[model samples]
Target chain A: MNTEIQEASDILKVIESANKLKGAEEPSGVLRGAQNAWDLLSDEQSQKHITTGSGDLNSILGGGIHCKEVTEIGGVPGVGKTQLGIQLAINVQIPVEYGGLGGKAVYIDTEGSFMVERVYQIAEGCISDIMEYFPYRHDKASSGREHLQPERFLADIYYFRVCSYTEQIAVINYLEKFLGEHKDVRIIIIDSVTFHFRQDFDDLALRTRVLSGLSLKLMKLSKTYNVALSLSWIWRYRCSNKLEVFVWLFFNDRLNTKDMQERRNIFVGDDRFCVLCNISASEDHDHLFWPCPFRRSCWSSIGIQLGSHSDLNTLISGVKDTASAGLFSEKLL
Target chain B: MRPPAPKPPLATSTYNQQEPRPEKPLLLLASSRAAKLSLGCPLLDRFLSGGLPAASVTEIAGESAAGKTQLCLQLALLAPLSPLSSSSLFLYSDLPFPLRRLRLLAPKSRPDLLDHVLVAAVHSPSDLLSLLSRAQHHLAHPSRSPNRLPIRLILLDSIASLFRSDFDASPADLKRRSGLFFKISAKLKELAYRHQCVVVVTNQVVDVVEGNTGNTVAWSSGRQVSPALGLAWANCVNTRLFLTREVDGNGGSVKRHMKVVFAPHLPERTCEFVIRRTGVFGVEPAQRSNNSSEVKAHGYYLESDRTRKGGSNQHKQCTHTSI
Candidate 1:
């Protein structure tokens, strides 16, 4: 009993000391002061937004890029992820006379994909939009003419070209002080946060820790500094939408003999027969859904045609275009 | 061989009147204002909140060619010029001391600047231990009476070299190393506090391998590089600063970053600077500094405009998508 009690007391002492050290050394929590829900709501309301240069995207994003929040804009290659980042960086410098947040930007480029010519074009586009909107406010426009220049816009966006993951982390860790000194900066856009982390990293656990720490630091920065953070990165989802769920459910049913054939193919590699058509075609999700003769009629009978089964996103968009007209109208009615 | 009798306080006061008596509380308070040793750069001084504080162990940890030695050289060069008017002692290990580079950083006006900085080559951690322990006696009570300034700035460039191969990665060896670290730091701190001197040590960085899930962001060269000696020596230092370098691909200009990892007084802050022939200079945003008046005017206008339209605030409603 005495030995057990001594061990327990020693453990308790260790736990107490650990807690004390944690409380003393945890620097993340001490930077920002406490705020109630009302303060947050008020701060949120009064926050200025950076226009995305596209009215639709701006409208969809609840008044463009939000300050004090991290908005991830992700898409495949050639979908203009870099373009939107550049657009936001340029549009952030839009004059306060217009309905925009007249603040600077810090652009962290990991992939060396940032084009200055594209940024100049976007700046020109923003200036034209501002001129078109407030043509009558001649005095204000004249006074802010220098600020509206593409050169000035390009100059305001502080660009840090980081080569590797360590440089990326260093730049991000350095941003708190950078933002503190440059108070005019209201947005931080990391063009690609995952480019360096995705490749050349052998230890999976260390990569996850570093990436999570980077992301948490970013989130805290956006909140503490009240700066908008836009991170563009590729996300791989195992299951994304209802279509994927339907596919999952179709395979999940053990009672369904049709899916059983596809499942049985896993064990019996030679028997590659389509369950629905009884044809000697290799069975897969795409073949069973659209291309197979037995299911093609059924899909046409339901008045749905699949276009471009190259990718899931295109497939979803195709379905949305054909089926969503009636569904949206019915909901509206 | 008897110990000298303790001198009477009144007699010592008259004897030490040539220099300010350091024992008085009033004089100590006056000296506290001049406690920091400036690094010779206004921008760095500002970034460090009036340079390195006296009576503290400051560790400047960095990878190779991160300008750690350059910074220490500048600090040593400028130590005698500070308000305290004290000299610096630089103990180097591993590589030979860069005397040529030191001379390049030395200004043309101060021809005898090197004389103020005392340099010594320490072969091992044991050598450093004995040196510092011996210096503690000299620091507490200086034998030399007058004319010469006290050594208030003590710098050991690359403390990692001394113990890199001395200890193996075993529990027992690590425990011994940790004890030595504590002993060295305790003596250094004692010397600093008793003599009101500054202690600065440069530490090399090693690649972070695994299980380092700490809040500290010590990174370099596409991998996380942590300060050598691990957590044992980390506890000994009063302040820790990390220096990182990046080579801009196209321009090829090397940008060096210095950040405070942890400090009693300073917040975690970083600044970018470049090393030039003269000294290390901070890379200020050129346009911002040049067009300061215009930017200020623009900001003033915006502020007034904001206050004028403060009463009529509006919010645009948009579709909210749950992430």
Candidate 2:
């Protein structure tokens, strides 16, 4: 028993010592000590924004893309999510005197859609914008000419091409060590984080988990390293929500009613009786449009019989066929 | 004969060091008090006696769309939210991971919960084996992983998929497949034991045809469905939870049921749950009792045939009421 007690104590001592060494050896910036809200606010005030090169865009974005935050840029394919990513990669390197962050960028291309030629052109455009805007001082312009070269802008941005999701994860995992060595990197851009993820996945739940995991890691990296993490993804529309919006816009007057039974819970009213036919049945989409006695009479008077089906497409197509057949028969006679 | 290895710094080496370890009893005593990871739902966690237990393999077997994947995803998301603030490793061998559904389930405050869960896709048995081996190395060297928090939860979405397509039913093939299953489970058990991690593996269920009485699984959703991979694979898991889904009486929504088929600590139990956009929620006990009583009054009752030797049949049966 004595020996056991001594061994336990010895193990505990080793554990404590190992924890201390781990704490001491941890890299400086990775360890984020607790800070109050006031400190956080003050830090935000001191944080710099990388210019997006458009004045109106900069104004709306609160002086451009703020550092120490992960910003997701999403839009429909070809709406220029990648373009914005490349522009930011170039614009992040704008020199300090011009009120820019004056830091390099790390661009991770997952889609292989990143074009070096377009990036060079954007870099040229950025350099020209700087010279035109800050040409008040002749000496400053001359001295900054060398720094404003397009090639120099291109050189400052490090590009990594990842072919698969696994490669994407591996690159992201290596980023911490990379950032430690290259502190000048002010921004990291993943050109379409959803490419390989969207394809070849048999299990959708796993995809969500994997993508969420990646986003979480990116968020931590941005917070710890004080760099702007920009992630681009194919802007997705939730089909149900979008379809509902469209249907509401087109058929709102026909479908939605104040005394409708579906709205009874919301209005707390007793008038759920069908407004068209006073058969005392509750007013709903089916009762109002499909089976209502009044609606049947209206259709009969128009010489177009209606079916019991609730599908609007079939109903409309049936009506068209009846009308056309009647017109053709009249002409044939 | 092994060569002497170089010593790591004393303070940095304590937690992971294998030699000079504390006595077995002391280790067990400390681990017994160690916190279990929550299943996210309060009631389910209570039913699980805290949450998923460490150092054991738990299998969740269910048919398609039975919410097995959703339950696993919920666990992955919840592991980080717990006070332990530990990370998880999700090994997906099935379909594309559902990022949108997970986002819907994630709480508003910590949308970044996904970041704490590391996910890897394994296409086949060999791929899964290699990944597990590599994972063992990564867990041993905590510095190698991206997140600071150690992985306390390792979830394999479905174990049956990797083995289902890769092997034929030939006797030799079956033997090889069972060997692989044991190898995979052993690796998972080792990792769970060494890291004190909770290992959860989801499984696919195969329908049991009538007249085939050989090792048939129980009935769920009025149809006989049993966990796939037969008895050989069943022996590897420490605990088994079966999920079943049936259309509600109203016919608008699905009512999901989870039952503990076997576990060392937990009793044979069953519960009703619903999957919402927020997360999976267990039905309250009061509501559950009321529901069962109502069903019984309507001449219906849950038939859980416990008398069967190897397994029990759990299904809802209804009797006609003479009006």
Candidate 3:
């Protein structure tokens, strides 16, 4: 084998040895070490909770979102990302075993899309079957009586709106405080994280910095509260009518290189970046994943294989199907 | 020294003052185990695990005129009057049908079924969300016995219509539309858990791009691909059944063909059903003789060849039945 393979093999051996050592430690010592680590990681005890969403989706996400991690869902317009997030929040408030966390959800709507009517629709959809099997009991009996009501289930969801990035941060902070006081909030949904940050930060560096901060904050909240933090991302499109021969030439030059270097290392100066102008537009989730040439290029840089059906809706459906079937073993790529 | 021992003899009373406890009756024993009711459609019930598992979401999607609303109406009428003693409720939002039509469709339905069905005409996505929350609130603490059958079913006919842009305007408005739907789905899941009711949502299908055809016919071919919500909505649902039209050689009329396109535990296959005046009926063909196919293929020898020509309408109908 070549030196690279040899070196990789050596590293693997070292990792295996380390794992063996970790496994061989005295049980008491390992327990003590685990306790110490847990103590150091928290100022207060963290409560782990799950959101009561669809069983398939929850199972695929490893039993709902993990606390202290920002699950970013990016899709073109009308892919149902926001709707899924809202449903997650509501589901979190339900008791476990019924596919819910039995805790409250904090919904932060950055784009002012939260609505109450759809909640009823969801409830209606959920109970349509039960009603079919057992009709209202009052009609068959001599005793005048009634059963079943909807108010108890609606009490679990809490909604909020954030107009700016700062406001979004404030909401997270407030959620942390609220969680501390009442350890029942298990899910946090922020609809459309792109709207606030995209408008204010034009420079790439500045945008990355802002996004990094926001992601860090969301991560911290997730871990600290043991709540799943789900955020939605809006997709942007660029349409180009004119074809430039230089674009293909530049790409070919990069492809001809012997060594595949990191993308960051290739940028020698700010002016070296490729430029393409004037693009048309259409809005849909498929555009965000595969159809959009710009996004496809970006994703390719990160080593993600874009599938033909890479739209947000298709992905969600695929995941849900797998999750429900108890076959969703792959991690989020 | 002494343990003296003269213990006084206890006096034995012959009369028992306490009355004998009566044996507990076993009259209600069988009724307790019969709590769960069946939907009567075995295949559909199997998809729902014997019946819709109480307190869960079951989503149903199909193209336009795909019987989604019709099934919802049928379930609404059938659910509340189940053989099981559990109580039920049906909540509908943004349905196109009038109350009178629903009443006519379910003439045999119990009057209480009508009352249990909470119908709301939602004009916007936001309003639909509010209706879900309200229904949940009512289901949790009905004015009846808490231990009795609680609100059992929630039916959302064509959830996609609520997200259509024609109902709203502006990016802000679209966001609100989708956000509201998200929240509603979440709440319904919760309600399903608390009440052990099943949640069913009907969805509409939009055209989506199929593949790179490279065809360039103006007005129809340049950009022939359509758009759909795609993965996002699919991910949220636990089960998804796609209903479509299937050809029936017996008659030219349309028949409902349901396929378990995406489900956690169910096999992916299609089943056929017909819509009747009462409700959806699963059609099973009668047993046929081996020669029936040959007779059908030949369209039966002409009557003139055997006995007579120009058979009467009644005779034709009888022959058709025989075939």
Q: Tell the DockQ for candidate 3.
A: 0.01
| Candidate 2: docking tier | incorrect
Interface RMS for model 2: 30.8
CAPRI verdict on model 1? incorrect
Tens-digit per-residue lDDT, A1-333, candidate 1: 999999999999998687666565543442335456776798788887887766687789887889878888875433356666877887788777776778888888654445453355456666766777787884655777767777778778787755444446657766776677788888999977876554333344435545766787788988776443321111112222222222322322321232344454534345556656867776655566657899878766666776758764466556757676545223212
Q: Looking at model 3, give its docking quality level.
A: incorrect
| Clash list (residue pairs), candidate 1 | none
Better of 2 and 3 by TM-score: 2
* Every candidate's TM-score, chain A alone: 0.57, 0.58, 0.47
Which digits, one per residue and each the tens of the lDDT, describe model 3 over residues A148-175? 2223334555656443344454455456
B1-323 in candidate 2: lDDT tens per residue? 11122222111011221111111221243353355677887668756655777766788999998899899889988888775578889999887987788777878888678788898999998898789878878888887556567888899988999888878899968877876765566567667766777899999988886665343266667788888988767656667888998875666677788887765445467888888877788885456455766766433221331122112111100100000
Q: How high is the lDDT of residue A102 in model 3?
A: 59
TM-scores of all predicted structures:
0.42, 0.41, 0.39
- Clashes counted in candidate 2 amount to 22
Span of ten consecutive residues with least summed lDDT in model 3 chain A: A233-242
